[model samples]
Target: MYAGTAKFPVRKGKNYLLRIVNAAVYNHLFFMVASHNLTVVAVDTSYTKPYITDILVLSSGQIADVLLTANQAKAKYYMAAKVYTTHSEANIDNTTTTAILSYVGSKSSTTPILPEYNDTATVTNFREASDVAILQAYHFHIDDVYTTDFPSNPPIEYNYNGDVDKTLWVPISGTRVKVNEYNATVQVVFEGTNIFQADKPSNAYSRL
Candidate 1:
């Protein structure tokens, strides 16, 4: 709900860093500005090349930064942040909303207004803006750094028949436990395996 003009003055043409964070418990946020395109500069504390985009998709506990440039004259543009999810029982009645991004020293002092929540065109535009081109470009750069100089010998060796013989079997299970501190029932699940020796060599081969 922190919507308004930035405290600092925004200069036109110059790239400004926009640090975005999603604090919602379950919803993923898509941020966009009306008519303007954003250049994603970084994500998850990693720097990336500037790539043009409109929307930034952010899940809870994720952070991203984009370079916003004022290509046009001073004017108000709707800064919107919408939540998207695939949960069937999701409650979206109170999700999508817009904020104002006012340019400094512009002739128009009026704040930018966003389209209605149900506006189809607005939704489409946001979806189109969520491209990951910049991220892909960054990944390409990383790949170039690690020249493919694989070792001649393979890392692991396997034998069809080995002398050492110990075949184990493991089972997984879960149970509920009572906690006096919380005064509630807690479910505990054991991960991995419950080991047991194989009855026969053929049984071990069959399990494998």
Candidate 2:
């Protein structure tokens, strides 16, 4: 959702491919359209096995391409977006940003009701994804073993089938960068998503 306003017009009986990006500074996003179902076709730059879902779960740096059909009777519907806050104990954003999915000739005041702030089931169903599309970020496949005492797993045993609770969520003990060695194979997967990096020279992180 845009900061100031969110509204876009579309013609009826047309299929629209939405290039949705979760560019949140530090939060995942759950996006949906009122009275419409999204056919998710792609993610990032790769095409996914087409699946239909009312809600889309996106990481901060992830991108999804969904096909939307304006099949509903010509009327203004609400396109809602809210932060997916199951990663933590409590929600930080109370405002669910909304936009109007206006049919070129219809008007209405009804808005789409979004999911709860801490809806984990939807997020889990989306996360257990199966990748399609013969595309990868890198061409070369160099498998190397990680060498260090750095924690490679989450600090807790996370069960996606549970409700939102602070005690259920994993807690990061602290940032643990690997030790710098002269000649060692590095196999690390960095999740720098949902974070904003400034142009300052300092190596400080806004979020750990």
Candidate 3:
């Protein structure tokens, strides 16, 4: 897990780009900057209209870009990224806490204290509803509006002549048993068209 502070001089009223990448093997990441609202500008290499929020969730192999404005200059703030897990099994190993990013020197060089993991209940509650809404809107846009421009052409030609070879078939079988006694085996019939096609007019046919 990568976690450290970044120090950069900023002018008031100007927007700066903040890029976040979730490189964990199994955990998702949640990001927030202390006392500053993050305006998300892009996700997964796609541009989006900026949306202001306090927290952003990033899943594994995902990237997010946000525009952070230093509305006030020469101030210190903590930038935090924490891991999230989704497993429910008892044997699963969950990360206690991991930091991914932070902000360094400003007018002050001291680190801002962060809340304990157990103290983040309100943050989790707020993020849950926002995540659901964003995902639903994304799915609706992709399924209904974004799918209208796909090409309608068929993929393969149907006029090629081919040679015939032996056909192979497999039968299906099943059995039903009494609750506390022996079971009777039953055989079922299975039928389908099996074709073998020659390779490059030189080799023997291959079964499919």
Candidate 4:
């Protein structure tokens, strides 16, 4: 709810390389600069074809490298970021954080318009339109600390929307890892485990 105090000074007709990192542990972020478009060139140290958009979404711990062109009018505009949550009832801090994008020798400013907190359609379209880079190698130091025994499918399969089971209340704990080969395709499905006492509704979302 508080407008942030960060500021980035830019000159007109110049392109700035911006490296944005999402440090949140559980929330995906939607980032945008008022009246400006961002051209993304890389993600997570992997280079991709240039994808341009007005809004960018980054998952938890993800990184994006974008080019910001100071092509708008010579005035101050707010660069804002907000949480993009999938579940409507999920407890999250629904607040917007902002920074100032000031043009050289300008004083007037305006706030940027942002999407709703639960705008899943925009997030889905943004992810699907971009060509993401595939990681080939992982340099990790904890190879022995975790076992590569993560299961591909759930052990128990039931109607996720309907029944309540006592056995499914507890989750299995392990330090498991899954390794993939080069040029491999991986699909992940997150199952809702909790059963609601009331007739509350729920929603599901994925990056791809």
RMSD of each: 18.4, 18.3, 17.3, 18.6
What would the per-residue lDDT of candidate 3 be over residues 4-84, giving only the tens digit for each residue?
Answer: 435455666677898878887776666676666777767897865455777777778888898887774455555666655
Let me know the TM-score candidate 2 reaches against the reference structure.
0.58
Better of 1 and 3 by TM-score: 1
lDDT of 4 by residue, 1-208 (tens): 3254888899999999999888899999999999999988888988665778999989999999999999989999898899998777458888888889889997888787888888999899888656432221234342333456777776567666656687776766554667766666666655455576523345453332
Off by over 4 Å in 4: 1-4, 132-208
Error of 4 at 205 (Å): 43
Q: Model 1, 38-97: lDDT tens per residue?
A: 777667778654457666667787778887887767866667776665544344744556
Tell me the lDDT of model 2 at 21.
Answer: 88
Ranking by lDDT: 4, 2, 1, 3
Which candidate wins on lDDT? 4
Cα deviation in Å at residue 81, candidate 1? 0.4
Give per-residue CA lDDT, model 2, range 7-44, as digits (tens): 78899999999988888888888888988999887789
Candidate 4 — what's its lDDT?
A: 0.78
Off by more than 4 A, model 3: 1-4, 86-106, 109-208
The TM-score leader among the candidates is 4
